[model samples]
Target: MELLQLQYFLTVARLEHVTEAARSLHVTQSSLSKTIQRLEDDLGVPLFDRIGRKLRLNEFGNSFLRRAERALFELEQGKQEINDLSSPEHGTLKLAVTTASSLPNILREFRKKRPNLQFHVQMLNMQEMITLLHRGEVDFCLSSPSIYGDDINTQVVCIDPVLVAVPKGHPLAERDSISLLELRDEWFVGVKKGYGARDLVDSICESAGFTPKYVYEGDEPARLSSLVEAQIGIAFIPSTAKNSNEHIHYLKVEDHDLVREIALLSHKSRYISRAALEFRDVVVEYFGEMA
Candidate 1:
C-alpha cells in the first residue's frame, strides 16, 4: 500500500536475497523483512515463495510486480515532467546507444545550443538498450538496425553505408567496390559478434555464402580501422566513420546494398523533457545534413 513498501518489495524481488536487498536499500534485514510481511498481509496474499535464504516471486508476486513497476514508472515520469516545466533548458538527457560513431558530432551540436543541459549516455548492446527503453530508464536510444516494440517509436535518422576497409597495398584496394564473396578467403578485423556492425556483417556474409574469417576480434569498433591499416586484416567500417588515413582504403560492397539504418527510439507513452526533445532534434538534423 505504501510507496516504500512497493519500493522495498521490488528491490527484494530483483535481488531475490533478503540480506542483499536489505544491504542495497541500506536498511537492516529484520526491518526489510517486517516491511515485506506487512505488504503481503495488506494484499492478503504472499508475494514470494520462500526458498531457504533465497526468495522467488510466486505467481501472485509476478502479476503484482508488473503493475507496481508501471505505477512507479508513471509517478517518476510525472516528477520529471514537473522538473522539465520548471527548467526547460537545464536537465539531464539519459540516452543509450548501440553505435556511438556519430554521437560525438550530434552531441557537440546539441551542447553548443543548450550549454546547460547535461547528458548521461550509456554504450549498450542492442538488447540492453531495448530493455532499458522498456524499463523507462533511458529517455531515448540511438540504435542501428532499428529496434521495434509495440510501445516503442522509431525515426530513421540516417542510412549509413557499410564499407570495407583494406590496406592501401592490398590486391582488392585497386577497385572502388567489391563483393563480400570475394573477401571470403581474406581474414577480417572487426568488433566482437554481439556488436551491431558485426551482426550486420555476419548477416551480409551469410547471405553472400561465407562467414568472415576474423584474424582479430575486439570490443572497440574504432580499432578496426587501425588494425586494417597495419595489414593485420580488413574490416567493415561505416561510411560515417570514414577517415583520411593514407594507409587505408574504403571499398563499397558492390554485390549487396550494404547499409544500416541509425534510428532514434523512445517509448511512445513516456514523457520526454524539453532538453531531450532538443537533443533528438539535433540528432535528426545532424544526420539529415549528412544524408
Candidate 2:
C-alpha cells in the first residue's frame, strides 16, 4: 500500500528474481521479500509463484502490474512536469534509437538550440526500444520498420532507401542499380536477424524467391558498409549510412521496395516535457527538409 512498497513490488515483478531485484533497488533480499509480502497481504492474494530461486507473476500479479505501472508512470510524469516548469532548459531527454548514423546530425542541431539540455541516449534493437517506450522509460524513440500500437503515436520522419553496397572493384559496382534476384548467388554481410534492416532485407529477398546468404552477421549496422568496402561481402546499406568512403559503392536497388521508415514514437498518455517536444520538432523538421 505504501509508495516504496509499490516501487519494490514493481522492481521485483520486472526482474522476477528477489536477489537481482534487491541488488538493483539497492535493498537487501529480506527487505524486498518482506515488502512484496506486505503488498500481497494488503491485496488479499498472492502475487507471485515461486520456483526455487526464480519468481513468476501469477494471474493476480499480472493484472496488478499494469495498474501499478500506470500509477508509477503518472507519478513520474507529475515529477517531470514540475521539473520542466522549474527549469525548462536543464531537463534530461531520454531517447533510444536503432541506428546512430542520422542521430548525430539531429542531436547536433538540438544541442545548438538548447545547449544546456542533457541527454540519455541508448542504441537498442526494435523490440527493446518498444518495451522502453511502453514502460515510459524513454521520452522518445527513433526506430525503423515502424511499430504500431494503440498506446503509441508515430510519425514517419524519413524514408531511407536501402542500397546494395559493394567494393569499388566488384563486378556489380559499376552498375547504376541492381535487383535482388541478381544477388541470389552473392554472399552478403548483414546486420543480425532481429535488426530492422536485416528483417527488411530478408523479407524482400524471400519475396524475390531466395534467401540471402550472409557470409558474416554482426550487430553493428554501421560496420556493414565497411565490411562491404573490404570486399568481405555485399550488404544492404541505408541512404543515411552513405558516407564519403571512396572504396565503397552504393548501388540503388532496382524495381524493389527496399526502404526503411525512420519513425519518431512517443507514448500517447505520457506527459511530454517542453524540451522533449522541441527535440521532436527538430527531428521532424530536419527530416522533412531532407525529404
Candidate 3:
C-alpha cells in the first residue's frame, strides 16, 4: 500500500526482471524482493507469475497496475500543480513527440519567449507517445496524423504535406508530380513502420494497390531526404522536413491527400500547468506561421 512498494512493483512489472528492476531502482536485489513480497502480502494476491528469472504481470497485477499508475500520475500532477502555483514563471515542460523535424524551430521560438522554462522532450513512436498520453506521463504530445480517445484532447497544429524526394538525376525528378502507384516499383528510404509519417504513407500506398519497397529503413525521418539525395532510394519526405539541397527534388503526390497532421495531445482529465498552456500556445503559433 505504500508508495515505495507501488513504485517498485511498477518498475518490476515494466522490466519483468527483478534483478534488472533492482538495478534500475538502485537497490539491492534482496531488498527489492522483500519489498515486493511485503506488497503482495498486503494485497493478499500474487501480482506476478514467475518463469525462471523473469516475471509476467498476472491478471491481478494488470488490474492493480492501472490504478497504481493513475494514483502515481495524480500525485505527480499534484506536485507539479503546487510548483506551478508557487512559481508559475519557471517550470518544466515535459513533452513527447513522434516527429522531431519541426520541434527544433518550435522549441527555439518558445525558448525565446520563456527562456527561464525548462524542457524535457522525448522522440517516441506513435504508440509510445499515445501510451504516455494515456498514462499522463507527459504534459503534451506532439503527434502526427492525430490520435483520438475519449479521455484525450487533440488539436491539429500543423498540416505538413508529404512529398516524394528524388535525386536530381532520377527519372522521377523530371516530373512535377508523381502518383503513389508510380513509386510502387521504386526502392524507398523511409522511417520504420511505427512512425506516424511512415504509417500514413504505408496506408496510402496500400490503398493505392502496392506496398512500398523500402531499400533502407531507419528511425530518423530527417535522413530520408539525404538518403534520396545520395541516390540510395526515393522517399516520402514531409514538407516540414524538406531541405534546400540542390541535389534533391521534391515531387508532389498527384491526386492524393498526402499530408501529416501534426497534433498536440493531452489527457483530458490530467491537470495541465500554466507552462504547458503557454507551451501549447507557442506551438500553435509556431505552426500557424508555417501554415
- The C-alpha lDDT values of all candidates are 0.90, 0.90, 0.90
- Across 192-240, the per-residue lDDT of candidate 3 in tens digits comes to 9899999999999999999999999998777787788889999888998
RMSD of each: 2.0, 1.1, 1.4
Per-residue lDDT tens digits of candidate 2, residues 113-225? 89999999998888888889999888999999788899999888999999888899999978989888999999999878877888988998999999999999988888887
Candidate 2 Cα RMSD (Å): 1.1
Q: Which one wins on TM-score?
A: 2
lDDT of 1 at 279: 84
Please estimate how well model 3 matches the true structure, expressed as its whole-model Cα lDDT.
Answer: 0.90
Clashing pairs in 2: none
The 10-residue segment with the lowest total lDDT in model 1:
217-226
Clashing pairs in model 1? none
**The 10-residue segment with the lowest total lDDT in model 2:** 220-229
Mind sharing the TM-score for model 3?
A: 0.96
